[model samples]
Target: MDEAPKALQRFLAPFMEQLTQKNLGNAVELMNEDERNEFDRLLGLATEPVRSFAPYTF
Candidate 1:
């Protein structure tokens, strides 16, 4: 991540916020927001299960 470009980091900010917050349902909700919904949703889905028991359920 340290090597990632600034724009890439900015673009991923929202998804990172949601991931850090551990809001699974918000991932789905985030899909409806503007600003690269595809990327946000993808990352959201990918990171939602951190520190969770249902690691692979979704």
Candidate 2:
């Protein structure tokens, strides 16, 4: 995240915070289509393994 551009970091902050707080549903619900797409793309770039317990209907 520290390596991300300022604007990108700012754009993702709220969703990242929600995820950190374990509020997946809220984060998903709050994202518009574009946001959701970008988030999904970013998730693919994660170095560490990621897991999701619930299916997201994006």
Candidate 3:
């Protein structure tokens, strides 16, 4: 069970790195106008700041 998570993490690490903002920005340059617009909208939703329900600040 413990090894399963570690193995999955190792497999996904490279893909996770490729999904960074810089890489995504570069990829967007290749997209058409409509694709860019849709990607930006989805990225905005994915990256929107989360709201905290706690009273104390981090």
Candidate 4:
């Protein structure tokens, strides 16, 4: 992120905001069953929970 320039960051700000806050269900309501299934599958990958581990000290 440090390498990303301020201009690019400014451009991405609004798109990122929409992505974080948009309701997936509302956006997918018009999709056909197959399209909906594909969306669900992809969304599952993105939403998968990451496991956290406690820090180990030397």
Per-prediction TM-score = 0.29, 0.46, 0.46, 0.43
Give the TM-score (vs. native) of candidate 2: 0.46
lDDT of 3 by residue, 1-58 (tens): 3344455445334544666564544665566787666555655555667676987766
Deviation in Å, model 4, residue 4 alpha carbon: 21
List candidate 4 segments past 4 Å from native: 1-23, 53-58
Name the candidate that leads on lDDT: 2
Alpha-carbon RMSD to native, per candidate: 10.8, 11.9, 9.8, 9.1
Error of 3 at 51 (Å): 1.1
Candidate 2: segments with Cα more than 4 A from true spot: 1-11, 16-22, 47-58
Clashing residue pair totals per candidate (backbone < 3 A): 0, 0, 0, 0
What are the runs in model 3 whose C-alpha is more than 4 Å off? 1-22, 54-58
Model 2 per-residue lDDT at 20:
50
* Winner of 2 and 3 under lDDT: 2
- Give residue 45's lDDT in candidate 3 (0 to 100): 56
In model 2, residue pairs whose N, Cα or C atoms come closer than 3 Å (at least 3 residues apart or on different chains), thus clashing, are none
Task: Quote the RMSD, in angstroms, for model 3.
Answer: 9.8
Per-residue lDDT tens digits of candidate 1, residues 1-58?
A: 3333454455556756877565546545565456556556545655554464867787
Instruction: Give per-residue lDDT, candidate 3, residue 41.
Output: 60
